[model samples]
Target chain A: MGTWVQTMLVIMLIHLTAGTPVWAVLGQAKASVEKDRAAMGGQVQSKLAPGYSVETITVVGMTIKEYVSLDGTVFAVTWKGTGVPNLRLLFDAYFDEYLDALTELQNKKPRLRRPLMLKTENLVIERSGHARNMWGRAFIPSHLPAMVSPKDIQ
Target chain B: MAYRAVVIACLWFVSACGSSGGGNGSAGPQPPNVLTVTVGGSSVCRIVNQLCTQVTICQPGTSTCQTISDILVDTGSIGVRIFGSVLSIPLQQEVESPGHPIGECVSFIDGSALWGSVQLADVVLAGEPAVTVPIHVIAPTFAGQSPSQNPCNSVVDSDPRTAGFNGILGIGLFTHDCGISCEINDNNNLYFSCVASTCGSIAAPLPTQVQNPVWLLPSDNNGVILTLPNVPAMGAPVLSGSVILGIGTASNNSPPPGISTFTTDQNGFLTTIYNGTTFAQSIIDTGSNGYFFPDSTLPLCPMPDQDFYCPSAAADLSAAIFGVNAGRATVPFQVANTANLLQTGNAVFNNLGGPSSSFDWGLPFFLGRVVFVGIEGQLSTLGTGPLYAF
Candidate 1:
């Protein structure tokens, strides 16, 4: 579909679910992709591949992409651009788990200022970039489509 | 009385002429535009290949200056950010209203951030005239709120020891850190106005934003030339270089002949084609410790340091770099086993590399080469920047 039409549909969907709580994309339903865009206040563009679909949102200097499986579950999300997107909204229920792992990693390696590669039991988060240009991806191993690989998220 | 007069005369002569031109025959004064940069070597910065320098911060309009060392020299970012713990003198905080002070959250590619308040100060770089500009003071507890509580939720360094450097001096290719984006978008998430303990994102005008100290220089304000000596494959424990302010504006900073200049996009990004894939978000940053790019063929290190590559032997690699102006250059680089290099106890390496999402020519790329960073919208002999010439 056209981008303008997709954006309008996203906006209308957001308006319909205006009073609902903010939706997180990772491991959530595909419908939450529009809610994530609304929470970010960005424009949305959708594209379909073989077994999954990608929803991209552009806000300010950042771009976020949400990958949804054929079963309508968000399996992974990738972000790139100036600053990071709101991970609290994107990671949804998994935000605290990610934070705990990150804190543990920081405590272990106090002085290393390199790219982050955090892997928990079920969730994997990797970020790399510098100031003004940052990018990263978060995904769930079990939630990925059968035909999809982690490398395909980007 | 005569003995006293003799003693007084001797003291006068010694005080007036004892040390003038007596130290070394060929040693002359250093150029005002040159800032000596060091990697490791007695500096408290312990990270491998981390570039360090010193900057003088003074209270605005006053000579109450404090010079802090171990400040990271980062060409990947913009603006001067100092740790508040090392600052002795107080600086005027930038505010949007009577009760609200401006706080900033600068996130890095490493998934870490520096949270602090913006304050105006007289920044002295090398021997240049002090320029009063806004700078980020690294204070995670600014206004009694932590980074997690603030809008930007990321891993924030609380002190210099954990951060590996005293602060960062971002002499990149821009005038302001956020530039026009923060000036227009209130939800930019970089700048915020804090009241008591509550802070909300606010649109910060250009004048109030933290600025690149090099841009405010009276002359030599165009850009900087960072030159580091080449390191051997075995690496070195310490290395030294120079960051010459301005481009072609001084006798010391003139671009050498037979140089390649490539213009970047507005966001300071060039394109890199590696392994038959075109990565458009490539960047040259001294802040990154080593070359970070994606290559599935290279094996990764074991746990704890798995973020770095652990190849069996030294792997030779090459990539083609493309600028927005259709300028292209082919560059060859090497990636060695990180475990072997780290065990050598060397702080500087030209072959250390790791895995990353984009093609980042980190400090290793600056070695044995004189790279010039032309600031955006600034004119120089290399043409108007944002361009990188080497």
Candidate 2:
């Protein structure tokens, strides 16, 4: 039943984006980049850090960054700009859990103006900013490598 | 372009007494000067801390009109938006170069989103006729668009039933929504043009895009003043107020000499310093229910109510609001436990607040005050466009 529930969760999230898992190969992340590039316009850019690398794909009005471990596994995603990117595509399977946590938060405190900080057991999603200058990031906490801190994703 | 303050006040008093329920009225003597806004009046859709008003939308160039009630009045955003599910009139859709229907994905500060198509309508607010402006008719399935194709994260599903409000009327201090961003780039994703069943992002020209209906009025188009009576610390079951149109144009709407005015940036952001920390992008948004700003000392309600600040007792706090022109005014507010406040039948409270990075003076801040929002690039006695005065 536990596996069934997990599978059901993945199925619901697949309705959003491809049910991509964390710690996936760099090749799969590139495929997502290609798909996103085809869907959303703009050039794909990259930046190398000490223990990890970030692939930034710039769309028409926003840029999305995918943090990859030194071992080439995509671990996290972050985005900011005038327009909001397709969050469904950015977080993939993790988006469902994020939505659940967000629903819980909103139900508790409806009509809040704060930037959202949704933390589940395995994922942490933080989004802030008013219209036109919106920004947010999502990551799988358990999948992060030893050297990479959560702040590094941003 | 100013009218006598006494004349405005008389008209406001007469109109307040005349209009009992909601209906479509004219733009003659009424001047659209005063509109009654109710907070938490609907029983079935008992949305807490909600500020709502009645909006009468008409078929362009025709008398065929429908008055929509429970429309959420929001200052956090700009544009007169309605849900297609509640719209009875068949308004014309705005199309792009390729003859595709224009669609929009409006995202909110809380991470929720509204997906819809842009349509042309004559919006009548109070007694003003904002003629032939682009308004968003929120239809998630517009042009047979599927849920997967929609860009927004589906929190309320863009449905009024689930969202607990009829629609949103965003009259923030901006002339246009998304502004030059949607005009210059197609990839912004806020505006889209649909060919057949597939909608793709497209650059919407300024004239054709959604506009703040308040800015397009023939007369008294400068700005608006939202005046709400003070609610008790324990909260009230229902709250009533008025959104007076124009600033300094009429006596009742004029900014008093003692009133503090804060100028804003192009994005309508002002500086708010809380706990000695400056948040340059703060805004006075009536759309937000609580006074939202992060504070480490205040405790949060357990489990579900954790989104709001819930001290054991009410906490009095002070914050300085700064303008881009170096003007500043300090404001004192309070925050109480959300769980305790919810137990009461009252829908309005002046002391409710929550945790947020930006200092959001929500509906709670409007109680016992008259807040003015001057339109961008428009001239008023208060000064020029894009100013907030209280």
| Best candidate according to lDDT | 1
DockQ of 2: 0.35
Model 2, span B1-390: residue lDDT tens: 121112111222112323454422343344456777888768423667788887777777666666777788888778888888888778989988767889888887677777889999877787665467899998888877654456565564457765667678888888888778788887777888877777677888888878888888776789999999998889999888888888877667878788888899866778888888888777788877788888989998886677777899999899999898756898998898888998786788998877765577888889999899999998998788799888
How many collisions between residues are there in candidate 1? 1
Tell me the DockQ of each model, to 2 decimals. 0.49, 0.35
Model 2 ranges off by over 4 Å = A1-40, A43-60, A63-76, A103-114, A142-154, B1-31, B146-149, B153-158
lDDT of residue B19 for candidate 2 = 47
Cα error, candidate 1, residue A56 (Å): 2.6
Model 1, position B193: C-alpha lDDT score? 91
Best by DockQ: 1
The digit string of per-residue lDDT tens for model 1 on B104-207 reads: 98888776788999999888777677789999999989988775666677768888887888789999988888877778778778898987888778888999
Give the per-residue lDDT digits (tens) of candidate 1, residues A1-154: 5876776686667666677648578899877887877766788888998899999988877789999999999999999876777788889989989988887777764245566777888799988765667789999999988889886988
Candidate 2 backbone clash number: 4
Backbone clashes for every candidate come to 1, 4
